[model samples]
Target: MRLAALQEDEYALLESDCLFHLRLFEAAAMPVVEPVLQRCLVHSQRFKILNTEPDSRVLLETANRHVAIVDAVKSGDAAALETALSHHISTIVDFGPDVLPLNAKS
Candidate 1:
């Protein structure tokens, strides 16, 4: 996605999800979510802080990437957004059982 193709509504919806995921889990999706995140840290200068502690950096980076994804979504690039979303879903499915909370009422 070029970021210009996404409709306003689509961008808004994806942006919301990205923000929510960042708030809840620190990362929107794994592996696929990494690049977007790295870009943000590099752009935001948080990457330097991350280098001081790899483990902590990873956690923070994940959250940063979620924000980046939202930015990308807002960019309105349909292809990029679609790719990001696809990877996000894949990451969720892969880690779903471990990370997802079971229904307490069950």
Candidate 2:
């Protein structure tokens, strides 16, 4: 997706990581964002290298997951979001303040 498609607030939310973007997107009433967030959650589960600089494999895996989820959401398959959430709640919660704040925000 082009950076131009997202508002500054949306971009900031995205840059904040999986949980932040997920909660913000849900609060903003854009269900389409759920799948993308799910993909991020999944990617976070598969990789653990982020704490030690960057790795191309990790980045690529994450990006690929994001693209797949985005495509699924665009096609209106909301079930994918639930599937992702169920499978990766730990990763989602690990995003710390991002996911935690979602409870209060809601």
Task: Give the number of the best model, judged by TM-score.
Answer: 2
Model 1 TM-score, all chains together: 0.33
Clashing pairs in 2: none
| Index of the highest-lDDT prediction | 2
TM-score of each: 0.33, 0.38
Could you tell me which residue pairs clash in candidate 1?
A: 1-79, 1-80, 3-76, 3-77, 4-76, 37-65
The whole-model lDDT of each prediction reads 0.48, 0.49
| Local distance difference test, candidate 1 | 0.48
lDDT tens per residue, model 2, 26-94? 855867777776787556544543442344444444444454445545676769865654454444335
Compared with the true structure, what per-residue lDDT tens digits does model 1 show for residues 46-102? 433334333433334344445545766689787887777666556532223555467
lDDT of 2: 0.49
